[model samples]
Target: MILWLTVVQIIVAVAAGAFCLVAGLVGRRPSDFSVGALALVELLLVVQVVVAIVAPLAGNPPTGDLLEFWVYLVSAVLLPIGAVLWALMERSRWSTVILGVAALAIGVMLWRMQVIWTIQVA
Candidate 1:
């Protein structure tokens, strides 16, 4: 995984998480902005997936356990999707908070993935 891309993902995820958290705390329901932020995160994750697949083919394989990295990647992709679905169905401020939590989780997971990709020993 690329360091810059991972950093970008982390930054975006954290920012989105913060935005959703603040909105939810202020009694905001699930809205377009909140959902859109998650959508953006999802888009970035999809990009990351593509990069992960292509990076190895390009001779930039991870130094960590490939299986562990894949598990984290897959889970990170699924999280926001699940959160958005929950927000849509529940349509409440707490659901917004869930979205925030999911985004934040993704940020941490992305960081872990970065460590796994570049720092950890296989």
Candidate 2:
């Protein structure tokens, strides 16, 4: 994974998570802003997926276990989708908090992925 891309993903995920968390704490429902923020995170994950695929071809394969990295990447991609679906169905403040948690989880997973890509020794 690209260092800059990873950094950007982490930043976006944290920002989205914090935004939803604050919204929930303030008793806000699952609004467009929260959903949209998750959508943006999802989009970045998709981009990261593409980068992960092409990076190896471009001579930037990960230094850690490929299976582990892929697992984290796939889960990170699915989390926001699941959270958004849950929020839509539940339509409550707690659902917004769930979204925030999911985003924060993705951020942590992204950090692990960066480590797998650049630091770990397979």
Candidate 3:
């Protein structure tokens, strides 16, 4: 795993979470700003996934279980898309809540990815 890239992903995810939370708290439905921010986050995650895959092929496999890491990566990539879909359908303040929760979940998932990347096996 590329350490700096992972750090960037974590920061972006957390920032997206904060943005969503504040929007939700203000009783705002999901807006272009929120969706755009999430899309950017998703884009970064896709880049991370590419790096994760290629780095291993280039002989830099993570220290942790590859399966676990892949699972986290895939889930992290899917989350924002799902949240955006749900928010578009719901079209209410609750939709913003969904986005907020999704953002936070992505943040946690990214952090977990970092843990998985660095974990040592006995």
How high is the CA lDDT of each candidate model? 0.97, 0.97, 0.85
TM agreement with the true structure for every prediction: 0.99, 0.99, 0.93
Clashing pairs in 2: none
Which residue runs does candidate 1 get wrong by more than 4 Å? none
Tens digit of per-residue lDDT, candidate 1, span 1-122: 99999999999999999999999999999999999999999999999999999999999999999999999999999999999999999998999999999999999999999999989897
Decoy 2 TM-score against native: 0.99
lDDT for each residue of candidate 3 in 20-40, tens digit (9 for 90 to 100): 888888899989988888899
Q: Could you tell me which residue pairs clash in candidate 1?
A: none
What TM-score would candidate 3 get against the native? Answer: 0.93
The number of clashing residue pairs in each candidate reads: 0, 0, 0
- RMSD (Cα, Å) for all candidates, in order, is 0.5, 0.4, 1.2
What order do you get sorting by TM-score, best first?
2, 1, 3
